[model samples]
Target: MDSPWMKRSRRALELRDGFPRLMAVLNKRKNFQTIPSEVSSST
Candidate 1:
């Protein structure tokens, strides 16, 4: 069986690895939203 500490450490590592990917997705979504709004208001 895996140790308890090992499980927690693995979870933390996974989050750390995924955080940048998550941030990038979020940033792209925000930019996509902003561009549409700016174009609509400027027209």
Candidate 2:
């Protein structure tokens, strides 16, 4: 939606950083890291 929505979403979330940060760090579906990983092994 808008910038405000993004920031508010971050604050409201029980988790932190990820969902809101995705707007920047997320490039493709394959680029996302969802669970615990070996850094080079999963995501």
Q: Which candidate gets the maximum lDDT versus the true structure? A: 1
Clashing pairs in 2: none
As a whole number from 0 to 100, the lDDT of residue 36 in candidate 2 is 27
TM-score of each: 0.49, 0.26
What lDDT tens digits, residue by residue, belong to model 1 across residues 1-43? 9899998888778868877985676688788764445324532
CA lDDT, candidate 1, residue 35: 40
Return the TM-score for candidate 2, rounded to 2 decimals: 0.26
lDDT of 2: 0.50
Tell me how far the alpha carbon of residue 40 in candidate 2 is from the true structure, in angstroms, after superposition: 42
What lDDT does the true structure give each of the candidates?
0.69, 0.50
Q: Which candidate number has the best TM-score?
A: 1
- Can you give the lDDT of residue 31 in candidate 2? 66
Flag regions of model 1 displaced more than 4 Å. 26-43
